[model samples]
Structure formats: structure tokens, C-alpha cells
Target chain A: MARFGMVIDTKKCVGCQDCVIACKTENKVPEGHDRDWIVTESHGKFPDILMEIRTERCNHCSNTPCVSCCPTGASHIHDVGGVVLVNHDLCIGCKACVESCPYDARFIHPDGYADKCTFCIHRVEKGLKPACVEVCPTYCMHFGDLDDPNSEVSKLLQSRKYHVNLPEAGTQPNIFYLI
Target chain B: MHEIFTTRNNPYVDPIMAMWEWQIPVYLFLGGMVAGMMIIAGYFLFSGRHKESNCACFSIPFTSLILLSLGMFALFLDLAHKPYVWRLYTTFQLKSPMSWGAWILILVYPALIANILIRPSQWMINRVPKLSEIAGKIQQHHILIRNIGILNMLFGLMLGAYTGVLLSTLGSRPLWNTSLLWVLFLVSGLSAAAAYVHLVAKNKAESELLAKADNGFLVVELFVFVMMFLGLLSSAKPHIEAANLLLNGAYAPIFWVFVIGMGIVIPLIIQLLAVNHKVKHTPIAPIMVIVGGLILRFVIVSAGQYSHWFNAHFH
Candidate 1:
């Protein structure tokens, strides 16, 4: 019942992309592939400008369209903590899951399978944080079990005004950005 | 609100390069054509149109088997893990369109075989004496032949609709997310198949009947297409942009000239003329329909990928 999630404080993010490099290194995601990235938005005119920087990745939704669309069940949810992962051995590389994903989070790995952010389940299993969360210098990223009321991610959701990427998509994304 | 969101151009994550290429569109076109053929053949068999049924049954099964194999091969080439392709057969997922499509395609083969058995060719009976006996047994049981025809029609309908459902299930691509997509694909497939059969049928009556049928399908296809565009235009901003991509954007030339003009309009006019005895039947219109069908798949697949949420959100 433990739903793992992330809370990113956009106000604190610097758009440095260190988290991106960390994810690539940790996941060995290949030269031209990524597990996470940053999106920057600029609002208002030059005299009155508001620049917003936020890092993004797979939302790991409660209702994952990728999992629903995958023919081979290669894209599945990890039972332990509700983490979404792809079994490359079972993936036919049809790219159905890749297309179904509203976040554009999933990618076809060069070795031939659907690949996406795993929320570093490999590290989380070892009682450690994801590479992106660990490497973010500004500490803008927070990851924990959202189901646990005591967890930092849950507390952040209670304390902050946050918005998900695409509410209309109906995926119920776990990644929240603090306004 | 003048707000600008910029997504960094990262080919690594953006899916800017289409994962599906020429192979997918080719597979879709062939699959749709086969499905359309089966439905037409099945209808002829059930209606007791012996000459028409013979013409259709002669070519449908064998051609479908060959085309299905080629289409599967094309799909295999597109797989990153080609060796693991058998995993698609291991289990069934009700939620997955690809899973449904895989199962439907498997069922199509058996239905096609049954159809072939119901009416074996002279060459086939001559080559395999045992097949003649099987064909005789199958032909005697009118109920069995009727059942096969029904199965073929059902599977054909499923196959045709599934092609569009496959793309429409992709929620991220606004262009492919329409409810009308499956209907459009089904009508287009029927139209293409009718045109194809009209070209190949030896009997003038059958050929003319199919041409008339093709005209009906073409009209419905045009209407469904317009509905799809209008539906998308009325939805969210991203969906509107996706529609605009076909209406007047980068894909406008292909959408307007090829899919609408050459594919639907020109073929409709030609078929209408042929139906009215205004002009002699020519292969040009049927050939145009098939080509137009193929191009439609390619453009839809390509343009759907191009109509991404991030692209619309950022730009």
C-alpha cells in the first residue's frame, strides 16, 4: 500500500541539470537517453518576468496508461512500493507504452525495450534515495512514501501548494511541483 | 496570459524521432486491407452469391495469409528485442490494445483457413488430394460454412477497428486520441477493400456492386474524418493544435491533397461515374484508393507523433 512519490520545489530549483547527469550515470542510461530532465518556463514581459525551473521524469501514476497499453505486460508496477518498471526481457519494443505516456517519460532503450524512470527502486531497496534526489545541490527534490503520513513527501503535500503536470490526462501522477 | 514554457531539445527523452517508421504504416495498411477483404468475402459466401463468392474466396485466404506474414515480419523488424517477440503470446491483457490486436490477428488466421477449406481452389485440390476430401466435407455442412463466414466477418471487423484503436489508445498524442478514429479506420479499410475487390473480380455484376459499396464507404469515411477534426478542434488547446496540424500545418499538403483529394474525393467521383455507366471502369481509381490508404496510415502515425503534448505546451 506504500505509494512512492516525489515533491519538487520549483522555487528552489536552479536548472543546473546535475540531477540529470546523476540519473544518467546511476542508471547507465546510454549516451543519448535520459531517465529525468528539466523544464523551464518564463512568464510575463521583460520588466515583470517570472522564470520557473522544474525537473521532470516519469510520474509513476496510480493509473498508468503505459502499463495499460503495453501488450506483453513488460511495463509493470513494482508490487513492493508501487514503483513502475519495465522488464526488458518481456518488452517487444512496440512503443505503445511510450506513446500512451502523457509525460513523454518512457523511451525505447537501444538494447530494445521500453525504458523509463524507475524511481531508483534499486537504491530505495537499499534504504537510500534516488540518484537525482541525492545529487540535487539545491535540495529541491523530495522523495518518500506518500502513503506514509510521516514521510517527507506526504508532509510536503500537506504543507505546500502543488500542481501535477497534466491533470487532464487522468493519470493521477505522483510527481508534484510546489508553486 | 502571455506565458512561455520551453522544453530543452533532448532527443534522449522527447521521442522526437518516431519509434514507429515505414514498417508500421505498411503493416497497418496491409492488415486493414486483409480485414476488409475477409468481410467482403464472408458477406458474399453468406448471401449465396456463388460466382462472386468464388471470385472472393479464390484470392482472399491465400492473399491474407501472405500479407499477414509480411506484416508480421515488418512488425518484427521494428522490435528492439526481436527474440522476445514470443512473449506477446504468453499472456493476455484486457487493458492493452496491442494485446487485443495480437489475439485478434491470431484468430484471423484460423478463420481464414476455415474459409479456404470451405471452398478450396482447383490447384489446391489437385496438389493435395486430401484437401479435396476436407473441402467436400466442409462444403456439405452448410451450417459450418455459415459459421466460418460469420467468424471471418466478426474477426475482420475487430481487426479493422483495432488498427485505429491501437493509435487512439495513445493518450499522449492528441491527434490519435479521438473516439472517432476507429470508425474512420474501419470505413476506410472497407472502402479500400471494396475498391481492391472491384478491380480483381471477373464478374461485372460483382465488380459494379463493390464499386457502389466502395462509394458508400468513401462517403462515410469523409464524414467520419470531418467529425474527428471538428471533435479535436473543440477539445483542449493541445487537441486543437493537433487538428490544426492536419488542417493547415506541416501535414496539410499530404492530408488535403492525398488523403482527401486523391484518396477519398477522386476515388468517389470515379466510382460514382462507373456506377452510373458514365464511364468505363478503370483500375486507376482502385489503385489510387489503396495508395491513398497506405499514405493515410503513414501521415496519421507520423503526424500524431509530431502532435506531442510537450511540443504544444512549450511552443
Candidate 2:
């Protein structure tokens, strides 16, 4: 009954992209495809601009359009922690899930399966942090059960002023960013 | 100036989901065209035109079988996981338009085949001797023919609307978000079919009749186009950007010239002239309508893929 999510401190990210590399290497994502990426957003005038560094991936929303739009039920939520995962064997590679994702998270793998970051469930299940979470030089990313009040992700979200991306989308995304 | 830069670079989702290309559009056009054929044939059947010496419905059903199969082949080609195509039939996904389409597509086959057996051609029976027996058996049950006609029309409606709904259901693309696309594509399909029947039907009366229907459909399709454009332009920033892609972006020339000017407007004018007996009916007008229908699918599919969520900085 665990709900997994991420809480990242954009103030401390430093835009290093180590997490991006760690994800690619850990997942063995095919050439020319990255399951996750970094975004450097800046706002306000030059002298007073505030910049934020974000490492983004599949939000694993509570109501996922990708899963709903999948014709073959190839995309489903894992029972372990509500992680969205794709069953490559059943996938027809119609790319419907790819088009339905608002976060622009998924891509059709070269081998013809829709793919995205799995939240490193293999590591997460083994009581190890996701590769990206483990490799962040500044300890900016934290992964834990968002549903547990005692989980680090829940505590971080409770203690900080945070927001999820694309609130207007209403997907109720699990990932939270500390402003 | 507020600015945002992302290092996301997957080919399928760099700026948008560009994986759907010409193959998907071709399949949609053919599906729409087949939808048109089945509906027209069913209408003829319902009106007792099937009893006529040489009703266009007789020939249309036969051609629809081939055309629909060809369209399915195009869809098959677009499947990245070709080996697993049958997986579509394993489950009926209530939320997926494609699942609805897959089931509808299969149902269409039986409807079409039944229509063909309603009056199988002598030439076909000569080639396939067993067709005679099957045709005789089917013709025995008058009620079945009526049911087949209804099935054809029902499936045709779904097929035509499904093409647009297919694109519309994918909320990620701002360009395909509007429900008007369903009505737009259905009217376009009907117009395209009417034009095609006008050109190819053996009966001059039927041809003339379809010419008029095509004119009406063309008018509606034009209105739908305007509504779709206005709907997108009036929405959120991403939709406006998507509409601009057709209005004045790289796709503007093709969208304006080929889809609107040549496909809908010009053909409607010519058919209007021909219908008034002011000019002889030439193959040019109908051909333009058919080609226009195709080009519409292409423009929608390609432009839709290029449309993205608003840039974070701009937002």
C-alpha cells in the first residue's frame, strides 16, 4: 500500500546532470534515448532572476492517461509501490502511451516498446535508492513513500514550500519540488 | 526574459511525439474512405436500391472489402511491434479509442462480406465457385440483408468518427484535443465517398445524386474546418501555437493550398457548376475531393505531432 514519489531540492541541484547519466547507465537506455532529463528554468529580469534546476522523469500520476490510453493494457501500475511500468511483451508499440503522457516522459524504444523511467524499481525493491538519487552529488533528490507520514519524501514535502509540475494538468503527480 | 532549457532528447519525444508519420495518416485516410463507402452502400440498401438492375451498392460493397483490407495493411505497417499485432484483440480496453477501432474494424469485415453476398457478382462466382452457394444462402434470409445494412451503417459511423477520435483522445497533443475533429473527419469521409461514387458508379442517376450529396458534405466539412481552427485559436497558449502551425508555420502552404483551396473549396465550386448543368461533369472534381480528403489526414497527423505543450519560459 506504499505510494512512491520524489522530492528534489531545486535550490541545491547545481544542474550537474550526473543523475541523467546515472539513469542512462543504470537502465542501459538505448542510444539516443534518455528515460529522464534535466531542466534549467530561469525567471524574472537578469539582475533579479531566480533560476531553478530540475531533474525530471515520469511523474507516475494517480490518474495516468498513458495507462488509460494503452489499448493492450501494456502499461500498468506495479503493485509494489504504484510505479508505472510497461509490459514489453504485451506492448504493440502503438505509441499511444507515448502521445498521452503530459510530462513528455515516454518514448518508443528502438526495440519497439514504449519506455520511460521505472523509478529504478529493481533498486528500490532491494532497499537501495534509485540510481539518480544515489548519484546526486548535492543530495538534491530524495525517493520514498509519499503516502507514509514518516517517510523522508513526505516529511520533506511537509516541511518545505513545494510544488508539482503542471498543476493545471490535474494528474495529481507524485513528484514534488522544493522551491 | 524568463527562460527554460531542457536536456530531454529522446527522438520520439524531444519536442513532441513525432513517431506517427505518413503510415498512420495513410491508414486513417483509408479507414475514413472505407467508412464512407460502407455508409453509402448501407443507405442504398435501406432505400431498396439494391433491387435495382445495377445499384452502385452492389459494386461498392465489393470494393470496400478490398479497400478496408488495404487500409488495415497500412496500419499493420505502422506497428513497431509487428509480431505482436494480435495483442490488440486479446482485451477490450474501454478507454482506448484504438481498441474500439480494432473491434469496429473487425465487425466491418463481416458487415461488408455479408453485403457482398447479398448480391455476389457473376464474375466473382466464376472465379470462386463456392461464392454462388454462399450468395444463394444469404439471399434466402431477407431479414439478414436488412440487419447487414444496419451493421454497415453503424460500423461506418464509428469508423469515420474513430479516425478523428483516435487522434483526439491523445490529450498530449493540443492540436488533436478538440472533439470537432470527429465530426470533421466523418463529414470529410462522407464527402469523399460521395465524390468517389459520383465518379465511378455505372448509373448516371446515382452519380448525379451523389454529386449533390458531396456538395452538401463539402459545405459542412468546410464549416467544421473553420470551427476547428477557431476552437484551437481561442484556447490555451499551446493550442494557439498548434493552430499557428497550420495558419502560418512551415505546414501553412500545404494546409492552405492543398487541403483547403484545392481539396474542399475548388471541388465544391466545380461540382456546383456541374450540378447546375452549366458545365460537363469531368473526373477532375471528384479526383480533387478524394485527394483533398487524403491530404487533410496528412496535415492533421503531422501538424498534431509537432504541436507541443507551451514552452515553460513563454508560459
Write candidate 2's Cα lDDT for B1-315 as tens digits: 777899999886776568887888888888998899999999888777777777899999888888888888888888888899999999999988999999998888888988998888999889999989987897787677778888889999999999999999887788999999999999999988898899898988999999999999999998998999899999988889999999999799999999999999999999999999999999999999999999999999988988877535224
Q: Write the per-residue lDDT of candidate 1 for residues A1-179, one digit (tens) a residue.
A: 99999999988999899999999899998777777887777766678777778898899999999999989998999996899999988998888887788777878777888888999999999999999999999999999999999999999999999888887788999999998
**Deviation from native of the Cα of residue A82 in model 1, angstroms:** 1.0
Against the hidden true structure, what lDDT does model 2 obtain? 0.89
Q: Score the docking of each candidate (DockQ).
A: 0.59, 0.71
lDDT of each: 0.86, 0.89
| Model 2 chain B weakest 10-residue run by lDDT | B306-315
lDDT of 1 by residue, B75-177 (tens): 8898878889999999999999899999999999999998888778888888988998898898788777778878888999999999999999888889999
Cα deviation in Å at residue A85, candidate 2? 0.5
Model 1: per-residue Cα lDDT at residue A71: 93
In the range A30-144, model 2's lDDT, one tens digit per residue, is: 8788888999888888688778889999999988989988899999999989999999999998888888887889988989889999999999999999999999999999999
Instruction: State candidate 2's TM-score.
Output: 0.97
